[model samples]
Target: MREQLQELLEQRVLQCVSMPRNQLHECPGIELKKQSCAKRSAEIVKAKANGRIKRKFENQENESVLYEVHFQYLIKQRGLFYMEEEVEKRQVEFYKGILVSDEKLNEIDGPREDVEDIPVFSGHEEGQERKGFRYDRMKAVQYAERWWNDFNPAYKKFEVDCTNYISQCLHAGGGPMRGYPNRSNGWWMQNNNWSFSWTVANAMRWYLPGSKFGLRGRAVDSAEQLKLGDVICYDFQGDGRFDHTTIVTGHDGNGMPLVNAHTYNSRMRYWAYEDSTAYTPNIKYKFITITDDSDA
Candidate 1:
């Protein structure tokens, strides 16, 4: 039974690379159907999947087993003027050696709502010109690439960790932290506790422009205006609430951003997220350009 499960897991891992058109993360118990996107032209040149058993147990009648697998994907992609490789990962659950559900592990845990009001920094003069820290785009991008599919021991890993991961990348770029102990105000993570803006997608999306000190960002009109180390907020439901976040780590030949995220564990993925299972035609985005003292 173990061997049979292992073989099935391996075959399922390899199967994701076989169909690139859909790219949508499959929910448990649903067969992924290919959907056409007009802007998708990048071709996947090669692909492979690797899976490992995370846990397993016997079912009620002992007729089958229930278990979880950590599935990882390696893909080589080609575009009009570029060729690059990416490593993406997700988790899957199986019952009785049959695939039941597959998705980014803990998709339900992330992208929290804005439950608290962050107070404004009294020391900051909103209208007055202020010099900020130098944001290192290269360092941020490097950090994104280094840990896209892995978790750092310094921080707590969440089941839905998109915003937390993006905050780490911003910190790598020299974004300062303030408002410790005040979980509703400012953006700082300390002693296993963090501000809403530090870990919540909706909070960060709102806190960026209004913030006067520490990890501030200016709202942008389009994704194209963004450069490396910038952030993008996703309102997947298009109900005026943000649910996910990603960082710009690279770009495609057409100058579109190639983002890295944690929840789905994607690397060098298209910024539009048309491939995401959460994608909807009504989906909206908030583009943020990380500003530094040089902006003055």
Candidate 2:
């Protein structure tokens, strides 16, 4: 099922990439490039908001470009039934917050009663396109900014909210939530409005955080002991400050944690954990575990 699903997702992505932009619009429109999906999605919402488009569901020839067949299935099984409504609803609340209408809310109150509301398509990935793929967090942040802006801004926002932002990107990138938490549900929370714990720890499964094991585990006896996707926790000035967090997106050939964080600054960047920019020598470190949810 995973293989089939992955294949379907790949094919959809390729189709979106290979399909001509002009062919993607229902009406005569501009050509959409790979970098423009997020921007376009933002524009669609903006146009609807400005009354340029009278319809909620704009006729999108390129809808096929942004999604995969497997994603559609996942949507039916996971996101779609709730996505259009949930995303619209949350986006409005995040943006407008309590000022949105009860009448508009009523429209999506019930389940999609008709299975026909579900779309159908064969799914498969064409070939390997992972070669050119780089972890372009800056571009991801740009897309995210446009996305977050179209909605309400009352919900807690973070700079190096890398994990949270990545979660959003994954959703935008066509990954289904297997049981993740958002700020609303509180699967994760911030500390004093600015702290991080960029590792995953299920209370039901792991003890005292970082107890859950498997993806990749290593002891960071020194700064040299980290790699991509590895986690970093804070220990404030030896008084035990597990008060901050970040993730390692890459590493130097010598092995240093390339971190992406917010707080001090909002950006995906590289850092030396042992260096005392944010700490002192008495500040001890813990395990920098890793998890690759990509193939999952």
Candidate 3:
């Protein structure tokens, strides 16, 4: 019975996580989807000579173009979420829900097939219904830990500098790089001259030329349009200079966006988008977008 239970868990690990095959983190992975703007586009309205309105045949094409980055998220398997109810239930079921061991439940020295009460969780439900909801702050932090674990230590120590570390976290989350080379740029290369593009600004720019990874780059406006893995760069001085980069993890309870960034004060932390009061004084322009360099 015990052996059978172990096998079930192993299978659950594959279905819920699906990491090794997809290059996804076992804990949480970022996903992107299109979000449209609520406000009508300027092209949709026509101004009359007398300030009167007129209906013009503006195509739906412009409506689709009026999208902005409004949603950000980090998705994970439902089974991995630390639900006390589920945990206790599984323990009880595993031990046959009694103080004295029940040989009947473990007749084959493994889990019993009759343990139907055990919670079965999945990331997505049937017909595209989402099984798991947005993870919370604590889960996001845990996801960061999983992300740290998945990073190759050799690459982390040798190829990544301080700025590159921040960039790498964002890259793993889904922000793609551009100008970064995978080979032979001694200063930026490691592991046989594979140098990583460094700094938040430089790393943001790296996607301009595209890399070996298959990453696609697109310019977007507003944090709301961003998905969990999108990269957001800020021109802190509003002088057309992008000085900072951060990765969007997901949304908070109030629909405020959350971001993960490093090196500003040395530790990676989540920042809320609505709390502009903290850094709005220095922020000039905010550009959020999704880039995919996986092809390179």
Residue-level lDDT of model 2, residues 1-296, one tens digit each, is 23433443355344544456556542111122222223322112211111111223223321111111111111121121211101111111111212222112221123211212222111111341222122334443444434432322433554323344433432233322221222211122334241121222111112113322212233456556654444455544555324345455544333444454433322223343332234456665554543324323
List where candidate 1 sits over 4 angstroms from the true fold.
Answer: 1-6, 9-38, 60-131
**lDDT over C-alpha atoms for residue 60 of model 2:** 37
What is residue 232's positional error in candidate 3, in angstroms?
1.1
* lDDT of model 3 at position 228: 60
lDDT of 3 by residue, 1-296 (tens): 33444444445334433334344333221100100110111010111110111122233322111111111122222222110000000221222322222111110112211222222111122343222122232433344435432343545442213235444554444332222243212113333443323432544344423332333345566656656655566554455545455555555333434555432211122333222222445565444454432312
After TM-score superposition, the amount by which residue 260's alpha carbon in candidate 2 deviates from its true location, in angstroms, is: 1.3
Clashes of each: 1, 9, 40
Candidate 3, residue 280: lDDT: 46
What TM-score would candidate 3 get against the native?
Answer: 0.37
Comparing 2 and 3 on lDDT, the stronger one: 3
Report how far residue 152 has shifted in candidate 3, in Å.
6.4
Q: Tell me each candidate's RMSD, in Å, in order.
A: 4.7, 21.2, 25.7
**Can you give the TM-score per candidate against the true fold?**
0.77, 0.32, 0.37
- Model 1: weakest 10-residue lDDT segment is 28-37
Which prediction has the highest TM-score against the true structure? 1
Local accuracy by lDDT, each model: 0.68, 0.31, 0.33
